[model samples]
Target: MANQLSGLDQIFSALADPTRRAIVMRLCAGEASVGELADPFEMALPSFMKHIHVLETSGLVQSEKSGRVRTCRLSPDALVGAEDWFQQQRATWEARLDRFEAYVMKLKKEKEGAAAKRPSRASKRKGAK
Candidate 1:
């Protein structure tokens, strides 16, 4: 559970910034260098680099220095935490729905059983015979 919480912390922290979220979305296309990642943004290199740094620290991106260029790649496992969280939410919803279904079925059966025990209008009228 601690690991899950930490993973959620990282996911939320990394996503808190719009710039970092945009970077993550862009990185979905493939790996990219810092310059390539920063090209679309109007911010300075230092500001943009901060976003990259956050992403790297969050384990959302992997970067390595090769000569003068630092290339960054998306880490697929970083999303596992978020996916697990979503799965847990889905399971809870499904269980709630299943419970609701059972309740409704029980109500339906009770209604039918009650009706079965009561005399119909036609049967009551036939008592004139």
Candidate 2:
């Protein structure tokens, strides 16, 4: 569990950068050579490669060298645990919000019922006069 959380931390950290995210998005269609992947950005190769390194370390990407070219591909399965964690959190929050809404509705109904049992202030004033 600790290891899984650590991986999640790394994945999230890698995704925190826009350049890394764009690289991941591009890889979604298929694998690409490092040069092709780095083409869209204006940064130096070393700087760009740092982003790639982060993604690789996070396990969200896999790269292999063929001849002189390093081709990278997305590792879709790496995100499964993170996605599950998000879904579980969404479910838990939705349930809590539903309960809160129900409680508010119940309070509203009770307030209306109590008001129905009580006389209006105008009527009380008239009776007193």
Candidate 3:
């Protein structure tokens, strides 16, 4: 469990950067060489490489070198942990909100019931008069 949490931490930390996120997004389509991946950015190769390094370290991406070219591809499985965590959180919150809504409805109905059991001011005035 600790290992899973650690991995999720790394994945979220890596994705915190817009550049790294963009790189992962691009790789979602297909694998591309390092040069091709860096083409859309204005940063230098070394700077872009840092982003790639973070993604690689997070296991969100994998790269291989052949000859002079280095190709990078997204590791879809790496995202599963984060996705599962998010889904769990969504379910929890939805359940909590549902309970809260039910509680509010219960209170509203109880208030109505209490009001219905009480005599109205107009009826009391009519009796007095």
Residue 106 lDDT (model 3) = 100
lDDT of 3 by residue, 1-129 (tens): 999999999999999999999999999999999999999999999999999999999999999999999999999999999999999999999999999999999999999999999999999999999
TM-score of 3: 0.90
Higher-ranked by TM-score: 2 or 3: 2
9-110: candidate 1 lDDT, tens digit per residue: 988899998889889899899989999999999989999988888898889999998999999999989888888898999999999999999999999999
The 10-residue segment of model 3 with minimum total lDDT is 16-25
TM-score of each: 0.74, 0.91, 0.90
* Stronger candidate by lDDT (2 vs 3): 3
What are the root-mean-square deviations of the candidates from the true structure over C-alphas? 3.2, 1.4, 1.5
* Model with the higher TM-score, candidate 1 or 3: 3
lDDT values for all models? 0.91, 0.96, 0.97
Tens digits of per-residue lDDT for model 2, 1-129: 999999999999999999999999999999999999999999999998899999999999999999999999999999998998899999999999999999999999999999999999999999998
- Judged by lDDT against the true structure, how good is candidate 1? 0.91
- Top lDDT: which candidate number? 3
